[model samples]
Target: MPEHSDLGLLVLPEAVCLAEALCDLDWRRYVAMVELNFDLTQFYDHVAHRLGQPRMFARSIAWNRDGDPLRRWVMAHCGRHKQTRNQYWDRVRRHQLPLVHSGR
Candidate 1:
């Protein structure tokens, strides 16, 4: 898998897995995942819950996408520095959107 700057979290295996997973996906699939908040959010939520950490997931997305709109949305709404699983839960709390598995 290609090395992406976003997945560069020291001692975080989830980051590696996320990086590999995303890198392996086609661009359209990636966009769908983000837009639907399906597989991508699940991956992020699992990592955050397991690690008991916040911000890293958003940080990774932010670092990776830069000018990408999905990155911007993630950083703005999901990375507020105030909650756990902000990316996933924030949408859940505010939008009432539950996690939907896309058979990934």
Candidate 2:
């Protein structure tokens, strides 16, 4: 099967599988795993090495068309530290508000 579509996006089964595995991780763990604070080139390098597809990734990046899906996938899954914290507080408000409920 073809690894990429005509738009140069990563359509490889292995790449999709990798994206799924990466996205399943907790946001914090994903950030740590990807070292997201670093430049995106490092991310590309890391993924390429992990997938054993350096040439494919490199060419995709060079063509300026590949990696968008992977980048979007990573962004969608990670970098939600604030959102996670807010969710925790929301849970606390919803389930641990006995004082408020008692009007105390």
Candidate 3:
């Protein structure tokens, strides 16, 4: 099987919640570490619900000569900063926060 990118693993609803929790624990200090952080349970719940809808996760091509809409949706609408996963995890490890249970 092809390996999935960290963003491929995390851009969905369930994983985004954990990202939010990390941010909340640090009071926005780690905002640069993640692309998006959502603290509101209601909003997150809405996202989870929407993702469950039929055809919601379907892949399609971008028209209208625009750039990557998926990136815009994930970064802009989701309020995430654009950073590589390595940079994110490195910062998290350097912080030495107790929230992470699996980091080296």
Among these predictions, the greatest lDDT belongs to 2
Q: Please give each candidate's TM-score.
A: 0.23, 0.37, 0.23
- Model 1 regions more than 4 Å off: 1-15, 24-40, 46-104
| CA shift of 65, model 1, Å | 14
Cα RMSD (angstroms) for every candidate in the order listed: 15.6, 11.2, 18.7
Point out the worst 10-residue segment of candidate 2 by lDDT. 30-39
Global lDDT for candidate 3? 0.43
Cα lDDT of model 3 by residue, 20-71, tens digit: 5434534233434443334323333433444553322223211212544432
With candidate 3 superimposed using the best TM-score fit, by how many Å does residue 43's alpha carbon deviate from the native?
Answer: 9.3
Model 2 lDDT, full chain set: 0.57
Q: Residue-pair clashes per candidate, as listed?
A: 0, 0, 2
Of the two candidates 1 and 3, the one with more favorable lDDT, higher being better, is: 1
Candidate 1: residue 44 lDDT (0-100): 53
lDDT of 2 by residue, 19-102 (tens): 654664553354444433343455555567667776567446534644477666555544555476457558867897765465
Give the alpha-carbon lDDT of every model: 0.51, 0.57, 0.43
Model 2 Cα shift for residue 22 (angstroms): 1.1
User: Considering summed lDDT, which 10 consecutive residues are worst modelled in model 1?
Assistant: 27-36
